[model samples]
Target chain A: MITLFGVGCLVFLVVCALVVARTRDLLAATVVFAAYSLVMALVWQQLQSPDVAITEAALGAGITSLLFLLAIGRTRRTEDEEG
Target chain B: MRHVPALLLLLMVAYVLFLTMAEAPAFGVVDVPSRNLVVDRYLDPDPEETGVPNAVARIIFDYRAHDTLGEATVLFVAVGAAAAVLVGRPGPFATRPVTGTDDPILRTVARLVIPFVQVYAVYVITHGHVSPGGGFAGGTILGGSFVLYLFVFGPGRAARKLSPARGEMVEGLTALWYILVGLGGLLLGASFLANAAAGFPLGVPGKLLSGGAIWLIGLGIGLKVAATVANLFLHLAGES
Candidate 1:
């Protein structure tokens, strides 16, 4: 039997991932993805791999988000009319 | 078009996650062969073999110092590449003058915290053999402090203290130092990064100076990674 808390966390991670996929603004999507990584790190910690949790928090939450933000800064802003 | 591949990738990831969960080991059980090996032999080795208080540091810096050297080199390369891309333009300086109003509250907080942040960074690096964190974690924190400086003081002021060229030099030298230590083992007829095999003394376990060549390797990696990440952000902020 799945606990309510586990179900809630899984749903939240799914929602965050979907939002990251659908967001039009690249920077906003990067932030959302960072949040998703944080949730995943939490799940990893709950699974009792604190070392994996730390790596996820560092690489996923920190460096991956920074890389995305930098890439967004380098590129020209997407035009609203281009869709 | 582009979204097709991304969507497919996400689906594949979800499928993999489902499969992993389905086949996952029971909670608290050791399943993987490597995990079993590590738990059986090394987690709390006999005092004769692992002469250290912190087993993580002993594993990372003493037994696996070559991997640490390689990790530092990776960061050094990243710094070099970022500098080359961001600072290599040859036209007359294109930097914009700083014109934003400085927030006194932020500045005051930064002034109060920056010293402690730096001190903690050094302490974390030095005390790797006795604690939860080692060079990489401490180095990331040090890099984060510089990022905080960029956020509060603006890129212009931060750049004066940490120019891209200087950061590149520090990254290069420290990376060389890390690699040279590993190479020293080779010269002594042991495999690279063989701390005890290279004749360094693994001092009393819990002391700051113990763990043979681990502390030296940690210091080199800490300096190199901190400079590399700082340079990465500085270049991205266009201060290089």
Candidate 2:
């Protein structure tokens, strides 16, 4: 069951990564990236590195998303198409 | 086609990476060279040597403290550089009176939830030596609470609670405090950041007051990180 969960997390991570890369809506991408970080934290915990897991959850999911949200708030929410 | 060359390059890079991975030692194998005597020295000591039951904490706060200090310096410098770029500019960093929401639900929930978050952050920092979390995790959480406050109550009130000047003061002083603690080891005839060897008492391993300089250093790092995070948000979000 644990192995299944870990595999599911990896699959979800790949999907999130792809969506973040493809999405033009920067806010949506940032939210998806936060989900990616959350799952990555869980993966770290499953790998028995709880210390890394905590850091990942805080730094990756919490603070980074906030910073990105602020940056998005200041700038355009959608990416501009290149000429 | 245009895509063919890019695809070929990608394949070549992937092949090279796979070759490198094949050459590397297997993960989680005990007999690997990566699992050397140094690893054993850290793991097998039973917490008596470092007085930190958490091996990860022992390694970071005690065995390899200089690297941790370097990490702290990096955070400090990054914050400094960000402030330099943001403060003097006329864009996002411009001072503005915060427009706090009058939403009663947000105000009520924030009032109710923020204290518990602060308390949990304290727990993560103080119990670091014996637990999973240490300075960085706890400090970010502490900062996150302040950020939530800023989000709900706005920067005017948040600034009153932790002004930019006060935040900078806390950041610098906590860093200096970490160095002062390290200097104590040097003054005692041991090298910098020496814990047990410097003649400081290492109490019972599992206790809160156990890990000597480890505990103190963790506290300093926690406060420094907390200040750094909150200050960065205040700057980025605009302070009153």
Which candidate leads the pack in lDDT? 2
Taking the tens digit of each residue's C-alpha lDDT, what string does model 2 give over A1-83? 25899999999999999999999999999999999999999999999999999999999999999889877876668998951
Instruction: Put down candidate 1 lDDT per residue, B84-166, tens digits, no spaces.
Output: 76675632323442222389999998888978877887887888767756777677767767767876787788888788778
Clashing residue pairs in candidate 2 (N, C-alpha, C atoms within 3 angstroms): none
Q: After superposition, which runs of candidate 1 have C-alpha atoms over 4 Å from their true positions? A: A1-11, A37-83, B1-17, B31-39, B53-55, B90-101, B186-189
Show pairs that collide, candidate 1.
none
Q: Residues B1-240, candidate 2, lDDT per residue (tens digit)?
A: 899999999999999999999988876667876787898989965888988999988999899999999999999999898788776466743534345679999999999999999999999999999999999899999999998898888888898999988999999999899899899999999999999999778899899998999999999999999999999988887662
Q: What is the lDDT of residue A41 in candidate 1?
A: 78
Superposed Cα deviation of residue B239, candidate 2 (Å): 1.7
DockQ of each: 0.24, 0.59
Instruction: Give RMSD to native, each candidate.
Output: 4.1, 2.0
